[model samples]
Target: MTLTQHAAPPEPPAVAAESVPGPARRRPPRRGPGLLLRPVFLGVVALVMLVPLYVLVVNAFKSQQEILTDPFGLPDGGPTFQYLDRVFHNAQFDIMRGYAVTILFVVCVNVLSVVLAGPAAYVIARSTRRRYRALMVFFLAGTFIPSQVLVIPVVYVLKVLGLMGTVRGFVLFETVLTLPFSIFLYAGYIATIPRELDQAAAVDGAGRVRTFWQIVFPLMRPVVATMVILNTFSVWNDFVNPQIILGPGSGLYTVTTGVYAAVSQFSTDYTVVFPTLLLAIAPLLVFFVFMQRHIISGLTAGSTRG
Candidate 1:
């Protein structure tokens, strides 16, 4: 009874529009120009930054005559440790002691800055009252005032507190200098975190202090790391503040002050100048190279939600 009713050959399956192969879709123009542009720009920047560093390192091992003749060239008779050793043993400036003292200052300032700034920022960020807002504005105002301008007044204040030329005085002032921006950064970052976490901690019978440190502060690592890099560089390279505050009389020379002490007497001596300069910057350069990724990531994250 099939009656020769073979079903009409099943209609050919409809061709997918994609399979129909309309004129080949033009691929988005390969972003050739943009791809080339970024690497070119970065190369130029790196070249500019590296040139002086190159000159400094090359000349560091060279004699004054060699440096004067060919400052950019490699050492004529191989790199010398003579200058480096001299730097280590120089009677006027003990590089090792300078390292120890500077590290101590760095540690103290960072600790104090974090300790004071963290709690203050937590309070400022959480509060909504008019005075707390005013307080924030007040802190922000400090950033506009140059540290250079504050040097004299700071001297007077420190003197009154019997802290001038003292390590405590320098560290405390540096810590204060750091607070404004730290709080600003912390508040902005904290704004991005949900209040629900704080409430949850409170529900668990945790006080505000415990809540911030235990729950929220750990979350602030990126912003905190950013602040650390900034403060470390500031305190490390600060010639004027340490010069004026700690003073030569105090004999508390940071790397920069020690460099100035060593070099000021031998301004024309290339061996001393170049080697001392190299030593002064070497540790920081290595640190920055290693932490460059962290610096970029932290700043990027801080900027995003802030």
Candidate 2:
């Protein structure tokens, strides 16, 4: 009893006032200067980025003499359409044929990729099976593997398929290459949608295919827009894919490859160079401008998981 009682002197009566856990103190809202300066900083960044484009447009009209003399300066005289006309009508390069091929490339890749990816994604997002999950993971893994890395194997395959020089062949390659990214996007977006909708559709006697089209597909609009804009931009502007798949000399060359082939034609003529560059980039710029709103809305709309 004595040995037990001597122990520890009651440990200071077991202090009862230990600090209680509570909500973290919030940092004070950042004050005036930081908030005020953010927009100004962004504006400056935007201006800096636009400078190159400004240079391109301004010099695009200047005479070759003007370009050589004062390339950075504003247009010295009236905006000339001479080089623009040349870029458009130069039968030597067949600019419109390039445009047609490029448009076809974009349309085929964008439309087919989305159509094929959408169903694959829905299956991935809804299925409880491990294989579906594994398949989805397999697709996402593709984003990390650059197309450049597969050029040798792909070329061999294309040669085997006799698609090496043909437009359809290029389309086939582009579509296969495009699918993984498209599926990655669609699957992520569709996962955020409620399962209840699918269940409700099923209860209404809708089959899986019908449910996807009538119920799930419309809900996929945002991702579809995002897919179109992103894929179109990528495939349209891609120089490397076209360069390898369709050679620079190939008549089936897209705008990028065609324009590059024309580089030697101009022979470092800056006035022509500027306008040709402008011609090459105008479609992308126009596409971005028109879809800028849809693009923004679509990207933002699916960020939340519900």
Candidate 3:
């Protein structure tokens, strides 16, 4: 009975032939040149960028003789604050006044740009009308026209409007210049937001403007931040527009113009040139350090979403 009941011993499961260890697979050799290339290229690029900054910083603390003798060298003695102090107190160009005036212009331009561009972008983003699309094209067209080209025409227009050489005129013109790109950025970003949010807000008795400001505008902070930083840089660093628009005759000097005024007279005076230049850029450098992440994220998010 036991012999009858005993089944043939179960056969072992067949092993996959591929599972048998083959010759050790060889990995492709990494190219030594390719491996070293990226870091080497980056190092070269870094050197190129950092050399000027290094010179600017080193020379700022050194005297005229030290700068000329060894522009690239570290200060032999301890760094001095005298040059910076002189830059601050320069009677010919008040650095504090220049900062105040430039800051004011930056604030005015940002506020005006946001106020004007926000709603216009909302309409352009939501509208199906051909006219709205045409309006968008018009704004896009403005971005292609160089700000330098617009300077002469803008000056003429400002003069006709009795606003030339005035702070109001300068602020207004800068705001106008910002609108095209601001709207373009804003509209693209706004299109990425869900329309259901707008409908929900409307159902709650909110008007289009209210919905946009309260609901949509809050979501647009990233793009808006990107725009604010860009505009700040543009307005802050603009030498040509301010130099011409807020001419010396007007007694209004932005940081850049004041730098020109202080440094132009003493072009070869490293003591004056380096220090003033350093002071002028210090705030912006600090700002960029903090805001650089926002700039990259905002631009990338908008671009990716669009």
Give per-model TM-scores: 0.89, 0.84, 0.90
RMSD of each: 3.7, 10.8, 3.7
Candidate 2 — which residues are off by over 4 angstroms?
Answer: 1-29, 32-37
Model 2 Cα lDDT, one tens digit per residue, 88-202: 8765577778888889889998888977988899899889899999998899899898888888888899899888877777888788888998888788788889999988988
Give residue 210's lDDT in candidate 1 (0 to 100). Answer: 98
Could you give candidate 1's per-residue lDDT for residues 33-116 as a string of tens digits? Answer: 889899999999999999999999989988889988888999986998898888887787888888889889988999999899
What does the lDDT come to for candidate 1?
A: 0.89
C-alpha RMSD of candidate 2 = 10.8
Off by over 4 Å in 1: 1-26, 30-38, 303-306
**TM accuracy, model 2:** 0.84
Candidate 3 lDDT over 207-228, as tens digits, reads: 9989999999999999999999
Q: Please give the CA lDDT of all the candidate structures.
A: 0.89, 0.83, 0.93
